[model samples]
Target: MRAAVLTRPGRFEIEERPIPAPGPGEALVRVARVGICGTDLHIFNGHYAAESLPMVPGHEFTGTITALGPGVAGLEVGRRAVVDMNIGCGRCFWCRRNEILNCPEMRQMGITMDGAFAEYMVVPARLVIPAPDDVPFEVLALTEPLACVVRAARKAQVTFGQSVLVIGAGPVGNLHVQLMRTIGAAPVIVTDLSPERVRMALDCGADVGVTDPGGLRQAVLEATDGRGADVVIESVGNRALYAAALGLMRKGGHLAAFGLTGPEDRLALPILDTILNENSVAGSVAGMGQDMHDALTLLVHGRLTTAPFTRAAFPLDEIQQAFDSINDRPGDLKTQIVLGEEDTR
Candidate 1:
């Protein structure tokens, strides 16, 4: 099978190798489609943790199960599924509490392990969630990221009529906008450096989209009646934006920092302001299984769709170009790699 291998930072090599067999409690999946997300870019650029080279760098993916390993009772071959890349060690303090992202030995499929950037990839059977027959590949590929946004939304806890300010209009930001609207956030505002992204966010149900910092501040203040947004979500992974996020929120607002930043990143908090306003901030990582279920339920029922936002598609051979397209086309929402025929049950 052919796989795109990131042998080092800023490079890829498409090479042929023997197919890997699923170990005990695992499954072999024939790749269908893989979404190239911000994390994929981080992995490709070697900014991700520990910087392991010569690995497959795709986690947001959907595929058909080709085979199942021993003891894998609930899954079967020929089934369409989405793999939850977060593989916890199961016997840790974090995993025991169902907080797998904090497990010290956690190995993400695309981060620490080989992910779905190939014709075939082996995934733990327990991490696979069967996708519905009628769902399109595009939606299937988005299940993971949507699950991630679901986590962020839960952390932020924005309810009906509450003001929301999403500080990024990228793919993730658009997802946040749609989720916020679905949950009844009133006058949802999206801000970005790119005007196109801001427009895209507006199309995704954001009541206001601004491209400049001054405009964002004005929009937030106006939407919240001179106070601030009830909930502010930073999705752009910009330190400057994250630093300024607290100043854009209400006195008792919460900041859900959802973007991934450098490992050594630090924040300079306004100690007195935080104490005076009773403001809170929380760091949310990727979602767990239940979040994926909620995301899939939303997608299948047509409550939310990336169909309006997702536009770019590339074949595996053009993987390099696909990565380049993210930089080349900032206006597009999501870019995915089509491994073979776009198929369903």
Candidate 2:
């Protein structure tokens, strides 16, 4: 088996290794596709603190089940699936409360352990969400990020006939636009620095799109009849965008802080306005058990589409190019590594 090993920050080596066999309660997957995102970039560039060097870092992935270990029942080889990457100690307070993402000791697949950035990878069988056989692996690879967006949508309490604004039109933001419309939000709006991305967002069900934030206030005002958005999603991870999102929300709107920011980043809210307007702010991270299930369900039913980012795949040898193209080609909402020839079609 060939694996792209992140031996050090900003470096990778295609190493040959024997196909690993799963142990008890684990499963081996013949990886078909792995999606690259900001998290992967952070890990590669040394921004995100990973457990060790020479780790196989890839979380958002989809593939075919090839083998199962002892006691791994209900999952069979040859089945296609996506994985819920977070693994928490069951005895922790947060895990006990079903908040696995908040567990004191959490080990993610790609972040902390060897993940699906290779021909074969092993994972806990319980975390694998079986997906429909008919769906393409390219599209199925998006299930993880969409799962995180599911968590965000729930945190924001997005509902029918409400105005929602997504402050970014990249991959995750594209999912937000689609999910917002599927939830029946009216006039879903998106703003981004890339005009092409904003246009792509419009095609993904954003009723309104603005390439420049300069004109976004008036657009939001006009769309919502001057009440501002009922929910604002700050998925850009920019402090300026966070501050701007506050001003774009309706009096009682909820702001979903879905983006990642620096540890030291902070913002001063307008105290009087926050109290008088009844606005609320909530932070949401990646998906957990139910969120992954719901995301898979949505994808299976065709309620969401991955048409905008199903292509632009790279092979294991071109891992570095795949990471670099993310910034080079801003309009390419998604970049993935195709692990098998069968999935590339």
Candidate 3:
């Protein structure tokens, strides 16, 4: 087996290693495609506090089940699948309540354990979900992030005809736009620093895409008929964006913060304004199994398409170049590493 190991900050080494055998209730997957995300960038830059060194830093991936360990059933070898990265302690209060994202003992696959930045990976059977045979593996790799967006949409309680303001027109932001549109959200406004990303957001079904924060308030007001947005989602993860998102909501509107900010990051809010307007702000992290299932369904049925977001594909040997492409191309949505030949249905 071949794997790319992040030995340290700003460094990666592709090395050969023995193929891992799946433990009980686990399955060994031959990774076909892995999508690099913002979290992967943070880990690569050594900014993620929870990520340890020498980790195989990739979570959003799709593969074929090469082998199943003892006790594994239902899923068979050669099946196309996507693996959920969140591993929560079954005994935790949150886990018992079926809210694994809030589990105190939650461990991420790429952060706390080895991940799919390799030709093969071993995943717990419970975390594996079957992928549709017709969907490309590159697009299927997006299921993990799509699941998170689904969770965010649910958290915001987005309703039909509601106006949504998504702060940041990145990959996640575009997904939010499409999801909101799918549910009849009107005037899905997306903002970004890059003009290309703003255009991409518009292409991804956002009704309004603005690059200038200076004109955002007016844009939202115009789109909502002088009222603020019904829901505001902050996907940029900057303190400034956080404060601005709070101000963009209508009275009694909901704000879903899905961005991953720095550990020491803090935002100054208008406390009295929030109290007076009855605005609600919620922080969402990762997704539940049901969310993943819904995301897969959406992809399988062509309700959600990642074609506009997928920029390029690279081989495993050019992994560093793949990481560089992300930083060098701000407009690029999802840069994937193609590890092997994908199943052609």
Candidate 4:
């Protein structure tokens, strides 16, 4: 088997590696399509926390089960599946509370273990979800990414008929636009510095897409008759936008901060306004079973197709080209690595 290994920061090379066999409670999956996410880029750039050198760097992938170990009862050989990257310690306090994302010993497959950037990868049985029969490999591969957006939406609690603003128009932000429309059925305002991303946001059902966040805030105020947005989601991880979201949110509204900001990242806010307006902010991490289920349902039923967002594909051997395509083309939404010459199933 061939795998792309991140030997060190700013270095990745495809090399021959031994195929991993399924262990107890694990399954070996023949990779099909792997979605290139910002986290992959962060790991490539050496900014990821748990990502060490010489690791496979992919978490969003759909594939067929080639083999299943003892105790892996549900998934059958040749079953199409998508793996939830996070492996939580079941006995942790956070896991006891059903907050696996906050578990002290959480290990993400792509970050802490070898991931799906190859011909074969091993995954825990509990983390593998059966892909809907009707969903194509391209679409099923998006379930994990969409699940993240669903988690953010769940945290935001978007309400129907309410005004919502999504800050940023990247892949995650674009998903937010679609989910906000589907769940809230309300007009959505999206903002991004990239013109192409703004256009993508509009195509994804944003009522308005602006290239300037401050300008978009003004437009949101005007559209809401000066009341401001009922809900604001910051997806760009920009400190400036984080502070701005607080100001743009209407009284009693909630702000869902989904971006992964650095430890030193901080934003200023009006202390009095937060107290007087009763505004609140919360962070959302990985998805739970329910979020993943909703995301898969949407994909299978054609409600959340990523067709408009998928920009390019490359063979697993050309993984470097895929990453280059993602970085060079600011307009590109999602790039994927096609793992094999033929489909496994």
Q: Which candidate is the best by lDDT?
A: 2
Superposition error at 222 for model 1 (Å): 1.1
Tens digits of per-residue lDDT for model 2, 107-143: 8988878888899988889888898898889888888
Winner by TM-score: 2
TM-score of model number 3 = 0.95
Model 2 pairs whose backbones collide = none
Off by over 4 Å in 1: none
Residues 153-198 of candidate 4: C-alpha lDDT, one tens digit per residue: 7777776888888888888999989988888646698888898888
lDDT of 2 at 143: 86
The models' CA-based lDDT, in order, is: 0.85, 0.88, 0.86, 0.82
Model 4 scores what on Cα lDDT?
Answer: 0.82
Q: Where is the poorest 10-residue window by lDDT in model 2? A: 336-345
Each model's TM-score, in the order given? 0.94, 0.96, 0.95, 0.94
Please give, for residues 1-345, the per-residue lDDT of candidate 3 as tens digits. 899999988788998999999999999999999988888888888888344888888998899999999999899888899998888887878887658868888878887788889999998898899886778887788888899999998888888999999998888888998899888999799999889988888887899988988999999999899879999999888888888887788998998988878779987767887798888887788876888898888888788757765658888899998887677876668898889665454
Question: For residue 142, what is the lDDT in candidate 1?
Answer: 86
Tell me the RMSD of model 1 versus the true structure.
1.9
- lDDT per residue, candidate 1, 1-345, as tens digits? 999998887777898979999999999998899999887897887777336678988998988889998889998788888888899888888988768988998888878888888999988888888887788777788888899999888877778999999998788889999999999999899998888888878887999888887777887898889999999999988788888898899998999988777768888888898899888897788977788888878887777857654468888888988886678777667898888646533
Q: 59, model 3: CA deviation in Å?
A: 0.2
